[model samples]
Target: MHSLFILSVMLSTAVAAPFGLVAKRPLDDRDWTRSKRDGCPAYLTEGQYEFPHYMTQVSKSEPNLAFGPQYNGIFTPNDVSTVFSFDIPESRANDTCTLQFIFPRQEQLKTSSYAYEGTGTFVFTGYNPGNCPGPQTTYNNQPGNGPFPQFPPIHMEPGYAYTIDVGPCSVGAGTCVAGMTSTNDTYFSYFQDKDSCPIGIYTSYS
Candidate 1:
């Protein structure tokens, strides 16, 4: 009886262990560039150059201040945006995953001069070989709304690619800006419950 009880406990522990996947900039080769908005300098283009949207990779391990110059110290309020994409491995097929754009704590933001009061939105879309739809999930972050906002989880299928569009917009009539800290790192993370999968795991942006 004792052996059976021990076995049951072990199984319960395994079931409760959480596991998931993660993809970050620089490390995963998910670089950011400028988006098209025009009116900007020619050699200053990166992602697209139509709307002042820029994308550049940043690392927690090193300094990346030289990437986006014009919009430095501040992510343009509503006028600029960034994009990132990653692939879902076949091992996690048909798994329900919670997607989150991780950022530094509120206290960290408060201490940085680069921080701004605004609402940041993340749009996530899942795509397969020949099937692609509108955004599957959208997460919005507002000033004084805590460090992490509640974003709806998503179900991810194996062999599919995902794209996350992150943009910041002004809050109401006031200009909204996102602050950055020298010691803090920002990236997207995906979580999967252990009960629904074979293993539990946690991943970091670095």
Candidate 2:
């Protein structure tokens, strides 16, 4: 009877476990940089640069894990883009999920030498496979105003792979400093249970 009880408890714990993914930097070139001759802006580029990747905390006691492509270079006005694609489990197809973009806090940015304050426009798009489904969902926002802009809860189709495109644009006068700093790690968190997300992930700013 005790063994049965233990099995039931384990099952329930697994069911209640949070489902999500964290963003991370590349391992090989984890500490590299781009210069003006190498495509970075002369005035904006400084310090070490790293490739963008997705990460997840597989174990609570361990640090975040990194995955996905290792795109080189920096985020410049001419090319401020990064893409992350992931698959949703079939079990989550009916469940409501929330997508969030997590940015480093202002205090954290101050610690980085390459950090800069400026206005920039970012375009986010979710694409369906093969273009079979027309009219994909998209979100656009200004990153300079604040951090943690999130999309409304969505019902994602299970067993399907979805791609998220992040394109940052510089507005007039101000330079778009998206993906500019090495100290800053931009994260995209996917929550299967919306309530499981911490209060800090939600922001009042648009």
Candidate 3:
């Protein structure tokens, strides 16, 4: 009877899917039905996306732990990364888009020379399941933790804007959902806004 009761309790508390309530569904990567085009879509307008609080941060070691504005990462020094999402509507599927990132000039630590100036980027196809970044999101607006991010290809600059054609990553459109990974570089990294400037990854169509 004791063993049976323990199993029953475990079954009742499940994660996502059939665990308890909310259903976690993977991104649908169905083959696109629309014809591929060489030129940009006639209807494609410029897309500039920015998240003020951004979504939260994530830690590779502790996947489930939450860290944001107030708190840092999972360690004393705290290893954290921010994930930016570019959620294009299903209406704008099959559209070629540009993935660009901008890190303002003033955000970095004042120095004669530094390595964090040359940052990196990565792309993914998912969205954050937790709440958006905010005062309530985490401690010290540090950066929250969720899943993990990987990227060794994209190279970025500080105060200068560079873009690349990464789409339609949403091959079939299918309510294209993509993300940009911001991994740590130096002790003081870029990406965080300056005094009044906003630093982030942008999605634009031209």
Q: What lDDT tens digits, residue by residue, belong to model 3 across residues 1-206?
A: 00000001111111222212111121111221112332111111324342322344545556556654421111111344444433455555545544444333443222222234223332222232232334343234322322322222333444444342343433313322333243334233333332223334445543
lDDT of 2: 0.20
Best by lDDT: 3
lDDT of 2 by residue, 1-206 (tens): 00000000011111122222222222122122133233211111122111112211111122122212322212222223332222223333333322233232222221222222323222332222111111121112211211222221221111111211112211110211121111112222222111111111110101
Model 1 misses residue 83 by how many Å?
0.3
Cα TM-score of candidate 2:
0.28
TM-score of each: 0.24, 0.28, 0.44
- Each candidate: RMSD to true structure? 20.5, 21.2, 15.5
Select the stronger candidate by lDDT from 1 and 3.
Answer: 3
Could you tell which candidate, 1 or 2, scores higher by TM-score? 2
Better of 2 and 3 by TM-score: 3
